[model samples]
Every structure is written in structure tokens, then in C-alpha cells.
Target: MKKLNMISMSLFLLAFLGCRSNDNIEYQANLDNAVRKIHSDLQKELNTDVPSLSVYIVSPKGTYFSTVNGANGDLMTRKTYFRFASNTKNFTSAAILKMMQDGWLNLDDKITAHIPGTSISYVPETSDWNFKYKDQITIRELLQHNAGIYDVTNDDSAYHINGQTYTDYMLENFPDHQFSATDYVKVLSQNNLTYGPPNTVYHYSNTGFSILSEIIARVYSQKSNASKTYGNYMYDHIVGPSSKTPLNIKFPELASDKQLPIPYIKGFIKYADHNEITNQKNASAHIGEGNGIGSMEMLSVYIRSLMKAENVLTASSIQQMRTSKGPATTSNYALGCTYVPGVGYGHNGATEGYLSTMLYDPETDFSVIVVLPFWDLRNMNNFEKCLTTLNVTAMEAKKALEY
Candidate 1:
């Protein structure tokens, strides 16, 4: 429950995998086949609409599947790319956990204790950013999004200022902030937030996670010989090992840098007054540890790895990541992921042009990844239905294991 809850504290994604039973070869094989077919069906539906899809699937036992290429013999893997978005939170939490295990920083340690330049503050009245938390916004709180941190980008929602990417924005602004957690404090001070009594409630705050990232940077990246944990650390710790997906959820360390399979599949709505741009995609860099870019195969691999985690932390940690932090905001949120009925853990990425859902069920040893290059506000529940169907898919795959 602790690890699953930790997942809730991080960013939110929807998907997870259950433990792999090596003895159930037949079951695993059926799931793989179903995965391929699922992608096949998706491709057929999307062919006339989108550019290409590099479909992939992974099992609980390190066994993997990818269908970047369609079985119709026309499409070939298409470079195996998709934006992971907020799923990157899994990696962020894992990195912090690694730091904890390394004995570098305690999860209970006050972030202010280690982060040099960073100072915490919140708004009390209306349009200010002065008050920092009095106390109790511990490492665990930040990881769990209970730190009472609030967003401060784009009038607090602008993650990236300007046409500026994360790099451009950070380089221009964070230069003095470099190698210093105090720098994070300074950046934090720039925002208007308010703190509640510590741990009394669960509020999702990217600011808290960002602070955690800065703290990790201070301890492991700056203080240690490694210099930075970044995306590779996520692969080493969780993504590659826990889930069927192996894409580095943290950094572009594993990224090919080739022409990324454009995440958004631009399309037009017949009725909408404006030309509806669809399939907008951004890399994990967009969300950083909160939300990174990834593909279906990588996500699947990650879930399966959780079912068979050897990377670090106990299986209990993984379980905690899947548990609910409390009640969700009309959405079922576990630690790093969301929840669906019968499906233990899942997450959805809601951005401009992309829509994604990854669902996992431990009881069934089942997982499913669903992505659409389009965002239809009219049928937002489309994915909810898809989530339920995906759980059923997982159950069917589990049944095959019995066969």
C-alpha cells in the first residue's frame, strides 16, 4: 500500500502490470496475441485518419511485444514512438526512492534542509506568493502531492513560458538556479500558492514534485558522483525493470533523437468552427518527472516489471504506488496512476492534442495501453469506456493463462 500510494503522490498516469508467472506460458502468449490484435484493430480504425503507429506490448515476465508495423504487411513499426506525458511521474518517484535507499536523503527530511536556494511560500489572500509551509510538508508529502504546492506556470498553468521549450525556459531563467535547491525555492517564491495543514488532504501539485526533483538533483546529481539522476536513473530503477515498457521515462537518454514519430495526428472536425488540430505530442521533457514521453511497448514493459520488480524498492513499494492516496478528484487516482473498476491502477494524459490511458490489474496479470492522437472534448468519456474495455481485455488475457 505504501508504494502504490507513493505512485499517487507523483504524477498521474493510467496503466500498470501484474506479476508474471513463468509457469503460465500459455496465458502469457494469449495476452501477447491479444495485444497485437488490439493494436491491429486500432490501426485499422486509425489508418485513414493518422499517420502511423508503432504498437508494442509487454508481459509480466519480461516477455515483450511490439507491433510498430501492422500485420497487414503495409506499416512497419514506424519508428516506435509515442509521447509518455504524465506517466513520467513513475520515474520521478523512483528516483527519489533510490536517493532514499542510497541513504542520501530521508523521505521525512525537510526539503528546506537540503535544497539550498529554494524557499517554500504560498498565497494567503488572493494575488500573492509569500507564505511557505509552516511545517509537515515532508519528503513523503511531496512524493504524495500532499505538500500543498500549487502550479505557477502560464499564469500558473504555463508549464513552458514563451514558445520556449523546457530547455530554453530553464536555461534562460534557471542559470543562477543551477546545482542549487535554493534556486528551486527562488523559482517557487515566484508563484502564488497557499498551504493547508500538512497531510490533512491530498492535493495534486506539480510544484511539490518539481521540488522533489530539485532535491534529488541536489543529493544524487550534485552531491554524489553521478551528478544527475535524470531519465536514465528511471530506467535503471523502475521503468525498464517494472513495466513491460522500457523507454526511459525520465530523460531522452534512451531516446533515438531521430525523427520522433509525431505524437499528434492532426485532423479536422466536420462540425467545429475551427480547424481542430489533433494528436499533439510532447516528450517526457514536457512534464519532466511529472510527465515524460513514452510508447505503448515501454509503458507495458513498465507495468510487467512492477509485477516482477527487481530494480529497487520492495514489491510493497510498487503496491503502494498502486493504492489510492485517498478519494480522487472525480477520477480514481492511485499514487502515480489513476484507477478503473476491476482494473487496479491506471492513468490518463489530458493535453491539447493527445489522449492516452494505460490500465493494469494485478489480480488478472493484465494490462492495456490506449492512445489516440485526437482529443475530443465532446466524447471525453470515450477513454473511460475504453478503460473498462481494456480491463475486460486484461481479464480475457488472464483467462488465456488458465488455458
Candidate 2:
């Protein structure tokens, strides 16, 4: 009687395992179909000359769905690399948090604090700085976009030396010029451009992040007693040895290093009459702010690992990075992340010819990454339409995972 009872229990357990395997297969199939539908709908809506699009979705069960669409879609795969602008801030923020975890720095440290063994402050202190409250800004404020530094790239005033916005002046006259963090700070200072005093309001400033990039280099240099570029530090520490899975993300070390790796989707700037190939534009000017290069799959993997605090950061530090420091212009932004109401923490990136979005939900361990390799320069409204489509794609991908 005992042997018969044991046999019955073993059979029941096998049945249960088989049912779960079937369920997983069904769910994965549903996710794939949903991704294909999203691509089809986008192609239909765009109607004309749709550029390449890539989407990657990952679930807690280790199920993944990926799709590529539009021109040269057949050539693009999950491993294809592209420039992910502004999403670089996520990496920058992670580097700072890693430093904090290692007891190298504090969030509330003032930008004016000198390095341990160096007379140089975290930020450059020179007569060129015209802002009165430069010394009062904190590292946390910069991460939260509350540093009140003027955005040289986004501000729309004739404040530059050429009676044009800094972006316009650079694009028109010096498109090839390699810009550094100090170069941007110098421009803002020489023009006496400031939004307001530090921590007073949330004004998104790329220049603020430029300053943070410099701080990362300075702190790393002082701690290691060796000179290293920010890009090298990132590869050696944050995404290299310290990550759960060493990510394939890269930062452009020089302006002349503009070529993407083989098997990359081509980016373009759409004009009224023609579409110009912009796949090789210099990215040095946007370092730490908008100049990260990786594939959608790698980005999803990185975000998933980051949100889980797996091998990268402590849970407490990740919590602090996710909590909103204060109000923001569009959404509740945390240290280096943007919180979408029902979506998770992530960021959006838009540069000359590419747009990308990445989000990861810790509760569900779900991640969505999307990248498009086209930007309409002439039709500004097209940009909004593209963003909406990307958001819809993410929402649909999330819904598909529920099955």
C-alpha cells in the first residue's frame, strides 16, 4: 500500500511540471506575436519610408521577445549596436552610486569640495565661472537635475558668443569640433548663463551632467592615484568587472571615433526633400549625457540587472537612486531615472538621428528596450509621433507579458 501511494504522488508531480512547461511555451509564443503586431502597426501608421526599429522584451521567467522592422530590418538582429543618446546618464549615475557603495564619495558632497590629495575642486573654480552659487551645488542636485545650471544644448536664447544658441553655433560652424566637459562649462560660464541658484528648481541641464562626468574622472583619479579617462573607468569598473553580466556598451573616447561596429542599423536625419545618412556623426560632445552605444538586448539586460541590484549596486543605494529627489518638468525623475506612472524606472534618449527608450519594473522583473534610427529634422511633429509610437510599443509589450 505504501509503494502504490508513492507512485501516485510521483505521477501527479510529473503532470504538474508538464503543465507548467506548456504554459511557458504558450506565453512565449503570445509575446512574439504581440511584438510582430506592434511592428506591423507602426509600419502602417508611418506610411512612408519607415526607418529601422528594434524592440527587446524580457520577463522574469527568462522568456525574451525581440523584433526588427522597416528598411534593412532583415540585416538587423538583437546584437546590432546603435547610439543610445541621453540613456548614458543611467550609466553615469550608476558609476557615482558604485563610488558611494565603495565609500569613495557621498551624495551630498558639494561640488566645491577638493579631492583628497589634490588641490582641484570637484568642479573647476576659476574666474570664468560667473554663477554666484556654484560652490553650493551638491552631487545629488546634479543627478536630480536641480543644479540650476543652464542647458547649453537645449536652451533657445542667443546667449552664445555668436549671437546664436550654443547648439546652433556648433552645428553650423564646428560640427566636427570635439567638446569636453570643461569646454561646455566654460561656454556656460563665459556667457553667464544660469537658470537659478542650486536646488531651487528642477531644470534639466546637460551641462550639469557634463560637470558630473568631470567629478567622476577626478574622484577616480584621486582614489587610484592614476590618471584615467571616464570612458576607461566605466569599462574597467561599472560595466566591466562590477556588473552581473559584463555589458557590451561603449563610450566614444574621441570625436573622430564615429563609426559604429559592424551589424549596426543606419541612422538618418530626414529632410523635406532628402534623407541624409547621419550614421557617422561625432558623439564626443555629448559624453556622459547622450553618448552611449549598445544593442537593445544588452540595454534590457543591463536595466534588468540594475533594477534587481544584482552584482552592481546595493539594494539601499538602488532604492535611493529610484526614489524621486523632487518634482520634475515632465515625470517624477529620480537621481538618474525617470518614473513613468505604470511603467518602471528608465530614461529616454534623443539625439540627431536616433531615439531610444529603456524601462525596467522591479516588481515584475520585466524590461522593455526600443530603438529607432531615424529623426525627422524638418517635421518636428514627426518626432512627437515617433515618441508616441515607441511608448505604445512598450505598453503593448508589457501587456503581452501578462499572458
Local distance difference test scores for all models: 0.48, 0.78
Q: After superposition, how far is residue 241 of candidate 1 from its true place, in Å?
A: 11
Residue lDDT tens for model 1, 134-195: 24466766766666665432223444457653344663575322332233344555543444
Mark the regions of model 2 whose C-alpha exceeds 4 Å error after superposition: 1-29, 40-46, 71-74, 116-118, 129-132, 158-164, 241-244, 327-330
TM agreement with the true structure for every prediction: 0.59, 0.89
Winning model by lDDT: 2
Candidate 2 lDDT for residue 113 = 84
The alpha-carbon deviation from the true structure for residue 276 of candidate 2, after best TM-score superposition, in angstroms, is 2.1
Error of 2 at 106 (Å): 2.1
Clashing pairs counted in every model: 77, 1
- Output the lDDT of residue 117, model 2: 56
Residue 253's C-alpha lDDT in candidate 2? 61
Tens-place lDDT digits, model 2, residues 138-163: 89889999888888877766365467
